[model samples]
Target: MKLLILLLAPLFVVLPIYGYQSENLIDFKIKDQFDKVHEKSDFSDKIVVIVGSDREGSKYNDLWVKAILDSLEKNNTGKHVSFIGVADLSAVPFFMRGIVQGFFPSDTTKRILMDWDGEFAETYKFKEEHCNIAIFGKNEKFVSKYPVQKFENKIFEQILNDLRKLFSK
Candidate 1:
């Protein structure tokens, strides 16, 4: 019995470390580029789509956004979806935050949450140097995560299909 317990102990430790576990979005209160506070409760009853990227991954965020918007439009589910942009700007120094913020468009109505301390990305386990897309159901339950290093048709189709299914539900 002791030998068996020892063998299973490693499995128990490793499973929690690397195994897949269902996670729900935590109740987070963060500010957007416009300094508007957003919380998980604000998006309740709507399918939330989170597009996150680090400095190196910023280039791919636009492509992912376009695809997500297109999918929502195609399904006619725009009203049911809440899009949230999260920029992982943890690496930017305090003094440089203003300079980085200046780079973002000033006229856009869309709000992009600035993750100054990387808390959001760390919680979601967002991939570095890749466009990380996470879809949550209306209940705020995590549906899926797609970390795209390069854009591809298949990947786009998969995202489209996922959105379609979620909307259908």
Candidate 2:
């Protein structure tokens, strides 16, 4: 019994023990595909919509990313919110970074963050196969989170509804 307990102790220490912690965003920084730096300070006065996927092969993740961005664009909430799409590109070779960047247009309104180290995933305690969203309210504090299980029109409506409430507050 003592041997089993000792063996399991390491698992407890290394595994993610809790859900997303809001305090982690207080001093976070991430670089976008264009190599522009974005930090907590840049989003201080606005609601930041972070859509992220830690897994490199989840098709649903890609679909959700596009759906979220398109919905945000259609809603025209640019004045009050910032959109960040984080993709785990850590497995790509350093030399291929330029090629990966080329896939995106030079002037996209959406800020696509290249999470080359998967730091944001660890920080947010995000699941590898799902699209996770974190909304930071004004003053750079965490507001709410949405775990996207599937792509549907209802999810978009829910997001817009939440935004309206947040903006009203």
Best by lDDT: 1
lDDT for each residue of candidate 1 in 1-169, tens digit (9 for 90 to 100): 9999998999988875553534887777888887789888898998888899998887898887887787778767788988888999988999999889878767667688888988668777788999888888877889888899677888888877777788778
List ranges where model 2 is wrong by over 4 Å.
1-20, 55-77, 93-99
Lowest lDDT 10-residue stretch of candidate 2: 17-26
Q: What TM-score would you give candidate 2 relative to the actual structure?
A: 0.69
Candidate 2 lDDT over residue span 55-153, tens digit each = 543456567666656766787765788767788776778999888777755775756788887776667766666788777777666666677767678
Q: What lDDT does each candidate get?
A: 0.83, 0.71
> Cα deviation in Å at residue 161, candidate 2?
2.8
Q: Which segments of candidate 1 are over 4 A away from where they belong?
A: 1-22
Residue pair clashes in candidate 2: none
> Please, what's the RMSD in Å of model 1?
3.1
